[model samples]
Target: MNLYDLLARGFPADRSRPAFLLGDGGEVSYAELEAGAAQVAGHLLARGVRPGDRVGLQAEKSVEAVTIYLGALKAGAVFLPLNAAYTAAEVDYFVEDAEPAVFVTDPRSFLAEAQAAAPLAQAVPRADDDVASLIYTSGTTGRSKGAMLSHGNLAANAVALHRAWGFTPDDVLLHALPIFHVHGLFVALHCAFLSGAPMVWLPRFDDAQVIAGLARSTVMMGVPTFYSRLLANPQFTRERAQHMRLFISGSAPLLESTFAEFEERTGARILERYGMSEAVIITTNPLDGERIPGSVGYPLPGVELRIGGGEETGVIEIRGPSVFSGYWRMPEKTAEEFTADGFFKTGDVGRRDLDGRVWISGRAKDLIISGGYNVYPKEIELVLDELAGVTESAVVGVPHPDFGEGVVAVVIGAGDEASMIAECRRQLAPYKSPKRIVFVEDLPRNAMGKVQKNLLRDRYTDLFTAG
Candidate 1:
């Protein structure tokens, strides 16, 4: 089935059934959603979007944005959602590399030099292997690579997740995550769509809004940060959350402390899962079993998981219908990422116990996930290296109380910290920028002269905790 078809498959026989209950108390119904997506599909067609063509969208979170995402799928166009935090320069890299057919920005934005003048063409029938979306993920190499998730990849995961998480039509999802990433658009949206569940939508996460949403909702999926922030709010008591059936966390590892505290406070254990842009979701804690803290749980029904390097802790490798096809325009890099046995190397270090529960130790790629957003050190280091009075910079994710991991910059430089930070803010999205900048005489290096990020992490592991 085309991933787009999932949008309308089980849409209630009653079209008036609410698909989304806006934070402002407005309701968007099934019929309205269908009409809205069809209209936006028309717009994308007018902009020359067609099957296999990449359409880039960088807009703030809104109901209209969701319409456009669904519409792009209907048009058979690959929906590429860029983070709102990315600067124009960062977006240019994606546009130039992906060579998308259409670039859709905010209505007021003048970032696009050429607009699509050609009208829509006939619909292209999409097979299971047809690319559905392009999510750009960079490594420590500093080059952005687009992961091509096929229609089959998306549909398979949605089907598995709906079953694994025990989603049902009666469930009401409290949705607050940004639509740019897999956690929101693919995982969260798909579960809600597949189950015919109504989503209580929030433009962004707010503790008060989540507290209010919990009263009317049965399910919620978020990053670790959400639970931590909600736990901080005294109003989010077990009484207020008793009605909630499940609380899912992913996009970043959930601190064991945060997991224990959330269960203690809400009387519901947070079901933490594991996934990345290349794969929608790989593993998830069971919905109706003992949810072990610090473990991401077993692989989904059809997903295969194994440790690649050793019997102890090693890089996680997975193979499943839900796994993405390959990287866009980089066949060689794609080959390098996969093993000879066809399992995709996840670049995430993990271990699986005899019972099959998976535990994430750390990322093999030195990825910094701040507030559930991926921040590659090379991206920030590139920017820092370009500025004056900077010798070198190394970025690492230190433990944070609320964000799970906060981005910290360790530098060897004479530049003024305030000025360097100002430049970063001007270029980077707020989440990727270093929250704390510490100047050291020199970054710790190994015998190979490579910066030992491990040593840096060890040195400043207490940066946030001590404060």
Candidate 2:
């Protein structure tokens, strides 16, 4: 099944049922959603879009954004979602790489800019086997590479999730994430149509608005940051969330404390799952079994995961239907990322317990080497998080003349330097503890709320100069 067919199926059976609800505005029924998508598809078709073409969407989270996404699919064109926060340079990189057939933007201010950037391609209706999206990586290493996700790839993953999650027609989803990300676009929006679940889209996350939406939603998916904000609201009550059946957390680590506290307060276990842009979802805490804390749980039905390198610790390699085809026009990078056996090397270091729960240690690149001893920052960060005054912390390896690399901790919290040092020494091993602790007002974060460790490293490299 193609991605657009997911919505087509729902429209026939539940034409009058609500398909999308805008928080401040009103709702759109399944029939209305289909009609809007059709209209948008017609608009693209009239603009000269063709099959196998790439289309750019730079709209905020709303019915229009969702409609444009479906319309692109129906037109047989690949839909490239641009992060609204991205600068023109970043946007230029993706536009040039994908060479989209048409560019759709909100705010109307960017329409001229996008058109100027995309001069050659003419927009028209979409066709099958077209490139669906070119989702760029976070560029942790160097330049961001666009992963070429096909229409078939997205549809298959959505179908897998629809089956795995057991989403039904009666379910109402609270769509609170950014549309540009894979979690919101494919996992939430596409899965809703694939499973015929109605959804309410919020332009941006607001604590009280989310609580109000929860009263009418049966399912909600978000990153740990969204949950943290929701938990901060004083008026939030378990009774309000009683209607919500499934609450999923992804995009970053959901602290064990956050998980436990949320469950205690809301009577709903935050089902922590794992995925990346290269592949959609690889593992998830079981829906029926105990929602294990720390671990992202077992692999989904179609995904194959193995720990490679050493027996104790290795990179998590995954082979699955949901994995992206390759990076757009970057054959060399694509060849480097996957193994000879076809599994994608996720670059993430992870370990599995005897019971099959998988705990992600950290990114392989983020591993800190201090005095020739290897240390995973996530381990130290978790320990620091256990301390009373700590809110968030990032561990990095700074340049050290004698040791080669020294462990440095950049933290955001209320505690004094001495107290933090004592807490780290008490909780972690000698080598794992931070040699120098720097307290900052706030850590630099990406649009997705992930701490930009590279920026932190650049900011704190001076400390290691004298060491």
Candidate 3:
């Protein structure tokens, strides 16, 4: 069945039921949501959008953003949701690379800029064969490449998630993550539509607002940062969260301490899952079985996962119906990303335990090589987290003349440098321990809450100038 058919099915069951609750605007019923999407589809069709044509949406998270996303699906257009926080240069790169037929924006001012530079020669109606959406990877080390996600890929993922998560008509999702990323757009919102669940949309995450919504929401899916912030909130009480059936954490590593604290207070373990822009969602902690902390549970029903290179440390490759077709307009890159047998190389190093729970070590690119030994930052960060008065820490690799790259730990919290260094020495080997520690007020983070290690590298490079 087509993905849009899921929303269509909801119309007849209970059109009057609340379909979406916007932060600024009031609630929209299922009937209203259907009509809005239809109207947006009509608008796109009138503007020459046809099935498979690429439609770009650059907007803040709003009811209109949700409508445009679903409407793009109904119109059979590939919806490319761009981060509203991205700079003009970043936005230009995606538009030029994807060559979208039409660009949709919240503000009228950006139309002229898009029309002038985008690669598509002429405006034309959408066609199913046309590329749908091109999601760009965050270029931490190199230029960002667009991961081309087809309608079929997205539809299959939504259905798979619907079955895996036990999403039902009764499920109400508290949507706060930015719609730009696949986790928010495809996994959360799409799954909600596929299951006919109502969604509560927050423009941006606020601890108080999110906690308030949890009282009414049945399911809440968010990144680890969101959960961390929620855990830090003073108003976060068990009384507020008793109504929520499922609490999900994704997009980044869900710190074990944060997970434990949340469960202690709320009596619900935050289900940690794994996914990237290329595959959407690969594994999730089971709904009924043991929801293990620090592990992204077993692979979903149709998803097949394998560890390659070595048993203890290996690259994660996934083959599934939910996997994207390839990177957009980059055949060579696409070919390099997939293996001989067709498993998409996740570029993440991981290992699976006997119980089938997956543990992500770190990104292959982020692995630090110091004095002929490899050190995973996640290991050091976890150890530092256990140290007294260390609130948060990020371990990164910096240029070293002798070792090629040396490990550096930038920490955030109140503690004597001697104690922090001593703690690392106790927990890690000499090579694995951070060579230099820098105390920072806060680490620079991307929109998704991932530490911008590249920025950290630049910042510290100047601080530790060569003698």
Question: How accurate locally, in lDDT, is each candidate?
Answer: 0.81, 0.79, 0.79
Would you estimate the TM-scores of all the predictions?
0.77, 0.92, 0.92
TM-score of 2: 0.92
Off by over 4 Å in 1: 107-124, 138-140, 366-467
The true-versus-predicted C-alpha distance at residue 79 of model 3, in Å, is 0.9
- RMSD (Cα, Å) of candidate 2? 4.0
Q: What lDDT score goes with residue 454 in model 2?
A: 90
lDDT of 3 by residue, 369-456 (tens): 8888988888898998888777788898888877778888998877787767877898889888887888878889888877888788
Pairs that clash in candidate 3: 48-125, 49-126, 50-126, 51-126, 51-127, 51-128, 78-132
lDDT of 1 by residue, 311-370 (tens): 677789999999988999999999999999899999887789989899876677687878
